[model samples]
Target: MKAWRLGWARGVVELRQSFSNGGDLVSHFLWPVLMLVALFFLRDREFAGTGILLGTLALPSILGMNAAMGMVSMSQQLTADREDGTLLRAKATPYGVQAYLVGKVVSVAGGLIADLVILFVPAMFLVDGLVFTPLSLLSLLGVLLLGLVATLPIGAILGSAFPSARAQGLVQLPVLAMIAISGIFYPLTALPGWVQVVAQFSPIYWLGLGTRSALLPDATVVVEAGESWRSVETVLVLGAWAVVGLLIAPVLLRRMARRESGSSVAVRREKALQRVG
Candidate 1:
């Protein structure tokens, strides 16, 4: 109990540090803005904004960036700590490992939630000249929450998969690939058949589908929506993803810890020391 509370405290500290570092906020808003701007110019032509498609497309991009940041940042940062012996020292104690992991989730996920809200404001404003019902607002919130729940566990698992931060870049390739696979920029209709098949296995597509349903009009065409824009299946899939992610993360993390090495710790420590010196 005390350990969990302490973890929350540590998580809060990380959240603050994440916010203080402006990189996330910029990336979160910038890419989406560029996409929106490009769409704006395209809207002047007959090819874009013909219907609800834009909202559906944009929702996924926001959720994807949020999910990406949480997973990649948390994984790399905590793994860095692990390779540096921070988590190893905790592991020597009874509940230290649990505390650290809890704290990490709290910190990373909390920042992600804030970033989602920040994106929400622009989503409303950016999708202007369109009708937004009360139902739309509720759906948007639902999608955001569902996406958060679903994406965090993926982050935790990835973070714990590698032995150190040096391997983080490699471990994170899947996440980067997810952006392209999930059809954030182009429609999934345009992707090759195999790529689309691979996307179904990634959480990114589910998030994009969910968010698009929440924000886009009922009549808009979605790549995944064979019949309807707001398929109950999207919510179900996202919920399933979230549950599985949460369940699997702890086990994978434990496995990563078991694989930690002494030399790895020493090398990481030396790196941190070099940075400080």
Candidate 2:
């Protein structure tokens, strides 16, 4: 059918099945909640939602973590689709491939946003008096939109690159490491000069910076000249990365498509049987 109609149809199907993974959703959220609890109990004694900002750093940081986690999880789903021959089969139909692709990205993005709600709403009460100002809310939304745009395609590329299902599980460690080095949980100033330099090259760096900017109103206190902590030029960099990521993801998909062997399932099954015998 038509591309638009196909997009809609595929979106529905993808969301239906992808969202059906309720256990994965629970898994995605469980650890973060515990972390939040620790922050509330441990960090709270040290830092109150003092000053004008209430839930600024904590909420945004939580959002940033969700974005990172969501990207890796989304990638694994794509890799699974490939390994199971699901994506290859869908690609054979007119507009089916495009629809499925759109659906995959959209569902993942939606789920990530939903996760933000889950974390923030509960934390409003659970994490002590975390308040939101108009400007702070706008800033949070800005960072979130930019992050969604920037992260979705990167996840797609990684999913395509590491099509092995096992690879998906281990990939988050490196991603979390990038996040740590990117100064999401701590100040970049505390990290070594070389480590900071390495973190500067990461997408999460731009994301963290942008999110922090949204939360920290007093620009001088939050960030200043020559420091990579402020939104500064990271907004432009994030925008550039978003465009590049979306464009490159399709190209990567096309290249992977060329590698399909076009073998029947029967042949693969027979080969498996022969090997077993």
Candidate 3:
């Protein structure tokens, strides 16, 4: 209980720092601004036969992609902390690893939510055809919440498995590929049938589908798989991933922490300095 409280406090402090730090603030806003600009250009363009503005469809999909990218941020931050000896220091303290993990989850999730708001508010005016009824709002919230739970723990496992910050780059290529196949900027129906089959297995696809379901009008359903939102399938797939990730993450994180030591941190730091030099 005490550790949980301590973790929560630590997360709050870090979240505050993320907003206060000039570079971090710039980073937090940069992608959303780029996305908005892209949305601007796409706003007038219409999807073939669908009679929907590309931007209107894209806006919600981008939101989902951004939410899933939280996983990458989590992995990168973990690697950075490991290289800087933060993980080692935490290991030396009593129940510090538990506190540190809790703090990371809180800060990462909080930051993702802030970024979503930054994207969503300006997005409402720039794009039209969005339906934001009370039910839609609730659906959006549910999808976002589920998306985070599905991705974050898996991210923790990735972070723990990678031995160095540079190795984290390997995680990004697959994520980008997943985003492309997941229909963030475009509809999946336009893609090859096999690709759609592969994408359905990924969380990114479900997140995008869920977000699109929440924001786009019911008429737009004709373009989706089964010509419906498949809300049940979305929940089932994401829930399964969440369950798997939650079960595996703790074991992986504990194993990773058990191996952390001052020597390993020093080795990583030396490698990082060499890269910089």
Candidate 4:
């Protein structure tokens, strides 16, 4: 209980810093702005005679993509903290590992939600034909929450697996490829059947599908695979990932944290300085 309280406070402090820190603040806005720009170009274009504007299709899909991208943020933050010895410092404190983990989840989830609102509020003005019913709002909330549960633990595992920022950079390519195949900015129906089958396994794809189901009208289902939302499958796939990731992430994180030492941190710091030089 005390750990949760302290962790929540720490998370709130870090979340506030992210908004106030110049570089972090800029990053918080930049991606959403870029996404909005993309929506601007797509707002008027129609998707394959579905009569729904492409931007209408993309806005919610992009929201899902952003939600799933929390995984990347979690991974990157973990890598950065580990490199700088934050994990070691936390390990020395009482109940700190649990606290640190909680804080990361809170901060990352809060930041991701804020970013979504930033894009979504402005996007509502730019895009048309979106459904804004109470049920859809509930559905959106549920999907986003489930999507985070499904992805963030895997991200922690990735961060633990990669000891350095440079190694973490390699992770982005595969994630980007997943996003591409998951149909974030386009319809999944347009992709090859094999690709669609592959995408079905990705949490990102389920997130996208879930959001599109929530925000789009029933008629707009024409663009989905099999012209259906597959809500049950979305829930199942995301739930399964959430379960497996939760089970594995804690063990991996603890192992990684155990490997941290003062000497190791100093070596990494030296290497980082050398690289900078």
Q: Is candidate 2 or candidate 3 better by TM-score?
A: 3
Report the C-alpha lDDT of model 3 over 142-207, residue by residue, as the tens digit.
999999999999899889888888898899999999999998888999899999999999999999
Candidate 1 lDDT over 141-231, as tens digits, reads: 6776777777777777777776656688786676778876776766666678888889867767776766666655555554453645545
Model 1 scores a C-alpha lDDT of 0.68
18-71 in candidate 2: lDDT tens per residue? 557987667657876776765575444422233323234445566676775667
Candidate 3: 10-residue stretch with minimal lDDT: 45-54
| Residue range 149-242, candidate 4, lDDT tens digits | 9999989999898888878878898899999999889998899999999988889998999999999999988899988899999999999999
lDDT of 1 at 181: 73
| Alpha carbon lDDT at 77, candidate 3 | 92
lDDT for each of the candidates? 0.68, 0.68, 0.93, 0.93
- RMSD of each candidate? 3.6, 4.1, 0.9, 0.8
The better-scoring model by TM-score among 1 and 3 is 3
Clashing residue pairs for model 1: 75-159
Worst lDDT run of 10 residues, candidate 1, spans 42-51
- What TM-score do all the candidates reach, one by one? 0.80, 0.81, 0.98, 0.98
